[model samples]
Target: MTSRPTPRRAVLTAALAVAAAASPFASATPAFAGASGSGPGPAEGAVDHRAWATFPQWSAGRGAGTRVIGGTRPGLVIGDPIGTHEYRDPHTGTTAAWEYATWLSPVRTLPAPATEVVVSFNARTPAGTWLQTELRGTYTDRTRTPWYVMGRWTSGDAAGDIRRTSVDGQGDGKSSVSTDTLAVDNPASGLRLASYELRLTLYRRPGTRLTPTVWRLGAMASDIPDRFTVPASRPGEGAGHRLRVPRYSQEIHKGQYPEYDNGGEAWCSPTSSQMVIEYWGHRPSREDLAWVDPAYADPQVCHAARHTYDNQYKGCGNWPFNAAYAATYPDLQAVVTRLRSLNDAERLVRAGIPLITSQSFLASELEGAGYGTAGHLMCVVGFTESGDVVANDPASPSNAAVERVYRRRQFENIWLRTKRHNAQGEVRNGSGGICYLYFPLRPTTRQARALASVGVR
Candidate 1:
């Protein structure tokens, strides 16, 4: 029910490329391999998701003024500022000089030729700092494209921070980036992304000791053929199990915070995010909710809406932004990724992880939903003994009504299918199994195995 105006911006060509230090500074972090490959290789399957998340992977990558931090969670941090450059925050029309450093990931050749790529990140950006994610890729024909800015993000909404958002107009004719996704302009032209590299630039106000630590950086490359339906997989593992996840309904917040996407249904994305975030024992403190009206119950839901609202998209539903918001809490890590099947989702639930999933459907398509949505987010906490989806749906009239059970066949098709018809019978796009996964900096042994099983370690 939430829509936004096209984000218009003056061409922001902030190319203050400060070269990384050219010397090798040695360290003793146990660099691990890439999020051990899954889905399939370059010539098979419809999806290939790869990420550089461990110390060894970050170590394998070339970094300038960056250091590898090893602990329960191995990550990259800015050790030194390579140079200083002035950046103009496009949204605020403000400019400032900032010290920066960078880490470049090794090129990853996809297992399948992909028509689309979506990048997700996990990091904690302090008040005065932020990070930018970019990609440069080779086509199936070996021709290369320029580095496209996927997102320039900060967890803060303060005056000193740059407005966090995905660049609006990044493309090279053959492809274009829409929000968080990079799409091939003409998939029929027989061109696809074969390999790509990720560049992470860390920035902090000049001469400050503050730095950003990135725990995970990755992309989901997909080439799914357009189909209204997908074959259902046999249910296993997660049936008969459920996690005790808290619930909050977006409908109850109607007209409460219009400045943040007019609240109400527009708050579904962040409402669901907050549920999972709290399930893991984290929440906004009283000080964090101080700005909210004292009469408003569950003030943190309002807090989430404000912090996650993208100045560019003018909405709080930006996928990566929600994931980034979860990572803002200490010791939490989150990523926006695509799961191939319900079986895959079961793996995470088995490991005690609740997923925030995205989908678009008509009221008649998903039984018991009572209403339809062009786009919506809900927490998939578990599966019923009969294999139905047990979800903490935030579309209810109250928190007491938030927990719902959706049919397995109906939920599967709605979540996985990339195409669907509206109530009026017009064709519209679906979310294609997009999900937000959040866990601790150090997960349980079972959680670790479950995460690694889904290629997320």
Candidate 2:
């Protein structure tokens, strides 16, 4: 094995996983995977997206002491205390008693076997309340995988932060969880997940009325081909269109919050998340920023770095963690999904939704980046008239330098491919066109159609 490690799957040994991203398909999902016609099941294609966000969807879940809410924005909530348990936060070693209730989603079988699965949601976890998401899968051999903890999270620090995080060292001999992704151990073995169910355990301080309301609960299961390069989409489809998103470079705050993911450049995930979040008119309150250094340039960026930091991953690049963090904002919902091509991204971008993409590339591979990264996250704001990619890359030295237009062919190759070569010319994995989408909980009709066209609800 040549010695260059994957920044995302393994960030610490050789280098950190700081990367960029690609686009996807948003075809209408069938009601369930393997179901005829489009229904609520798994999306049928190279990628499958299934979500529960409507009244009927919430009502379908088997809830124990959990209320199926009916309203303009439907969801599930803690109806009554099912039981109590004490949680010892691994990050802080703080133990506390919490009353919890559960909501189990209907099992979804993929139309095609999947090598990886990622779960995300949009929920409001008030102070004294948080949620735990877990996944249990059935393999092609009909054997089942253990329930893997996807995330333990809250939106803000109001409840002492609780240090929202993903668990590590969780896996069976067959499959495992890498940060926010639940994946098969060896796709080469043809051991893929056939079906899976998600569990949401809502927790709150005991002896209180606090409850967590989740409006969007979903997962993306995909079997992306492993390739060194992919066919790029035709250029200039939605050119000359770019949204005005806030720009904050990860390099600017280098060395400021070293405790978070070891500080500095490791913060690309949260930094990119914060930019899109503010573009939608949300920011941390003054009290929220009170802990950050006053002299810091953009306190919100620092705030995001701290809040989205994953103690187990020891970095801020956790995919679902960042999506969950974006959902913490008012009237917002976020999900992590894969896109087929930049054309799909253009559809969403035209609909006023910016995306945070993960990618790895050599400096020589992607023009004008001026640097190579193992893994990095950046915001794709728009496309130029020439069909070039206009992104608010946080890797810049200053905020003003954050916006960049890159060649479509080169950008797509790096962000979309599954296999790549490091500086040492050793082959490694790419992000496989993974991206984070943040949008309104109640979207406009145009936005809804755009999201649906890209296979999101």
Q: Which one is best on lDDT?
A: 2
TM of each candidate vs. truth: 0.89, 0.89
Evaluate model 1: give its TM-score. 0.89
Question: What is candidate 1's lDDT per residue for 399-448, written digit by digit as tens?
Answer: 99999999999999998876677777755667768789999988999888
Q: Could you tell me how far off, in angstroms, the CA of residue 212 lies in candidate 2 after the best superposition?
A: 1.9
Root-mean-square deviation (CA) per prediction: 8.5, 5.3
lDDT of each: 0.79, 0.80
C-alpha RMSD of candidate 2: 5.3
- Global lDDT of model 2: 0.80
- lDDT, candidate 2, residue 230? 85
lDDT of 1 at 291: 92
Show the lowest summed lDDT stretch of 10 residues, model 1. 16-25
In model 1, the clashing pairs are 31-55, 31-56, 32-56, 41-111, 42-111, 42-112
After superposing all C-alphas onto the true structure, candidate 1 shows an RMSD in angstroms of 8.5
How many pairs collide in each candidate, listed in order?
6, 24
